[model samples]
Target chain A: MSIVRRLGLTFGLPIILLAAWWFASANSTDFFFPPLSEILTALKDEWFGPRLLADVVPSVLRLLAGYAVAVVVAVTLGVVIGTSRTVRATLEPVLEFFRAIPPPVLVPIFLLLFGIGDGMKIIVIAFGCMWPILLNTVEGVRAVDSVLSDTARTYRITGTARLRTLVLPAASPQIYAGLRQGLSVAIILMVISELFAASNGLGFAVVQAQRSFAIAETWAGMLMLGLLGFLLAMLFKLVENRQLAWYHGLRRAQRSS
Target chain B: MLDVRGIKKVYEGKGRTVEAVRDLTFTVDQGEMVCIVGPSGSGKTTLLKIMSGLLDPTAGEVLIEGKKVDGPPPGMAVVFQEYGRSLFPWMTVRENVELPLKQKKLPNARRKELVDESLSAVGLAEAHTAYPWQLSGGMQQRVAIARAVAYEPQVLLMDEPFAAVDAQTRADLEDLIRDIWHRFQVTTLFVTHDIDEAVYLGQRVLILSSSPTVVRQDLAIDLPDERDQLNTRSSPRFAELRAQVYSQIHRPKADAAEPVGAGATAVDGGASGYGAAPDLP
Candidate 1:
């Protein structure tokens, strides 16, 4: 019975939200406050109609490029730092200090260093996406069972072979967790970067519409960004599910116990 | 053959020092199986760790075939008490068994053959592709055993390898170890706290005194080489040996009123024999 109610809640909650918004905005006087229906119409007619693919493609490409770079750099460094006690000890404070600083706050510095371009935005996104991945990778590698390490040593598995065969696989669940978190941050920073400085992308489109007081168009752009974030998060979940099927099974078993 | 002489281990921490084992000595002849038993914290594990070259004794040396064991020797393999962690979860059972063979740089074909044979020897042929987490505790321990055997080491060291399993499984594993030891003729040094397990599986049992341990008694099992779990354990000889080892381990020290028997006298006569029984208050 609880399961059935949960299912209803999952399906019904969103509809209720849309209904409430639609009713509230039905009699609004402010031009900035567009109805949900108006926003949807603008989204369908302008955002997803003829120029749909072109507007979304560049933003997605930038996000992917930044995300890929973040994953590679963060994972490599994270593994190194995690595997060596001395390295971890030397670098952990620096990493924590950097992680505490918000990436958006670096926009002015990045603009100064790299200039106002896609390069700046990419750098920002990469920087934003890196911390979660790096921290999680370190944790994952450290959390690898000591007994497995002993077994590997007993087999005389050392150096690259040990890292490749034992450490990587053992640390994958945590690494994947890091990747998911990093990807989410990447999406957030991608929009944030574009909103702050970029000439193109969804953030630029939203800002442009808002300056002209094209409220519906502004809402449509915001809606698209929200949808993109949701979609990317869902995509990450799919990847995580496929990659961490065994981890999920183990979790289920643990929960049952 | 493996020889450990005057092995002493002292652990110093937080301004306090623990003498885990002191002046312990023992030897395992080629193809002979020996079991070391003592109370918890009596350094049974520390002794095994030193023997396997996982730890260096604070004083003394472990020699395998007359060569000093400074690090994990290629000729010796170890099975730990925690079966769940010993076998790599990411690798299939066959892969786990074959890993050492790979390290030995054996040909792929020979590695495959050894893995198959070892898995079958441990009754895990069908479980070759199963991950360690997919199997029962006993089966996982069997994979660990299979891994050790597949390495084809000259000596196998087990530290309470069956302690995590159920009674039925523990008995089965004890028999399995004996069978494998006999079949392969590999020198095996098994350490356990269970007296019955030590007597059941060992050609000779070396009982150690408590902390700062030393050998209390070295009892040779008179049981036949060929053993069945039921028949051997049910025999009168098995009971006598078990009782003998039990008494040696549990004898009260302050109550010196009882006239010391030959066995008691042997344990008490020499500082070398009884040393200091584990510091069990």
Candidate 2:
């Protein structure tokens, strides 16, 4: 498909809906349901200049830091637990107990423990994202093909070489599945964590607008959050396609054949 | 050189005990191609696994170059039947072939030469950049062969490597194996269920029995070294030798007392002795 057609297919409905809102709300007088034009103007006036650096940059950095820590910690622990039957058996119930508890509940506890700062929010984000990637990595490592394992063994591909060549790549597709799930979860928890006792962030800005009754600014903040989510999702898809090109191609070939 | 001495394997499950391989013994000397053929469920795979050090035997051991094989000795390489699963899908053909050499810690120049030579030897130099899944079944199997060949091991083990490909591809791969064996002079121990494949590939064919699996007949294939799919397979000698192996596979253990006929296993019409007759006076 051509780039124009693909873009039209993707954005056509959203554009139409935005246009409808633009025309429909042109003369809106309700405080909560402000005009789209007013919201756009409010978005630029409130967030486009000073807040972009002070609020948005810091929020994005914290999200990424938490996400990176979660990925590294989870994958490391998952490979260990998955590769060994004893470790998996020993930790499975404990992990299950922890995983059953809702992630949001930890935020207030984290607040009490770490106090209101970047540390608490980062921990909350990491804790929320850890479950999916960790479990998927464990599952993926466990499900590495027996033939491939045997081939690795017979070739004397041991230690780091075996892990690098066989274990990681073999389990990567499933790992990516977990990673993808964790990303949206991380985004959600980032906002949720920011909502409580956060002095600066996109979430803080939105809640702040709501508290002071700046209705159009509040709507504009929500729009920015949605736009941020969409852009981040697109960025994630580009990385995944690059990292797992071979996997996608392999599946496509298998499916067609 | 490889020696499989008195290998026995028994599976102790939750409810039952099953004997997979019982007192199996064989030897494949350096630069020799020996094929092991057995009936279905005869533990051919179990024996290969034991020899390759991928699995442990209840008794006995495998020795390569006089060193015992306990944990997949560095001197050995295996070409598995499931080519799709054996070759890493994430890596291109060149990467798959170069992986073992990386383990061996060879220099980049040496590694590249080995990978290039092996790929071309298997008629797959052009497909070096292609991933295993991008190729046909036969081509995938060729990549597996190239990987094994690049390892430059003393003993090469193949467990029905051509079983997944079509007949024509099977024939072509069989020739490829022979060519590699001739070129590299790597000691190859092949295990297969196909009788004709066994007869065609090996200098010596070992027929294995079912149940408590044991060697039934250690027949010697007396065809010319420069054999082809058409000429050698159509030869009378190949037919006679193939028939002997076929009957031996079907024969039960209870009728083991009768000695094989004078011309049963080798049927050497060309020479007096060609390494087939073991109990000759």
| Best candidate (score: lDDT) | 2
Residue lDDT tens for model 2, B1-281: 56666789999998999999887766676688889999989899999888888889999877776677788888888999999999999999999999989888899999999999999999997998998999999999999999999999888889989888999999999999999999999988899999999999999998788857877767888899998999999999999888889888777566644424333544321133223223322
Which structure among the candidates has the greatest TM-score?
A: 2
Model 2 chain B: which ten-residue window has the lowest total lDDT?
Answer: B268-277
Decoy 2 TM-score against native: 0.95
Candidate 1 docking category? Answer: acceptable
The root-mean-square deviation over C-alpha atoms between each candidate and the true structure, in angstroms, is: 5.2, 3.7
Q: Write the per-residue lDDT of candidate 1 for residues A1-257, one digit (tens) a residue.
A: 69989989877988898899999998787888977889989999878965466567778888999999999999899899998999999998898899999999998899999998889989999999999999999998898888788777767788888888888888989899889888888888877787776767776777777899889988888888888888888888898787677677556644664
Worst 10 residues of 1 chain B by lDDT: B272-281
Q: Candidate 2: misplaced stretches above 4 Å?
A: B256-281
Q: How high a TM-score does candidate 1 get?
A: 0.89
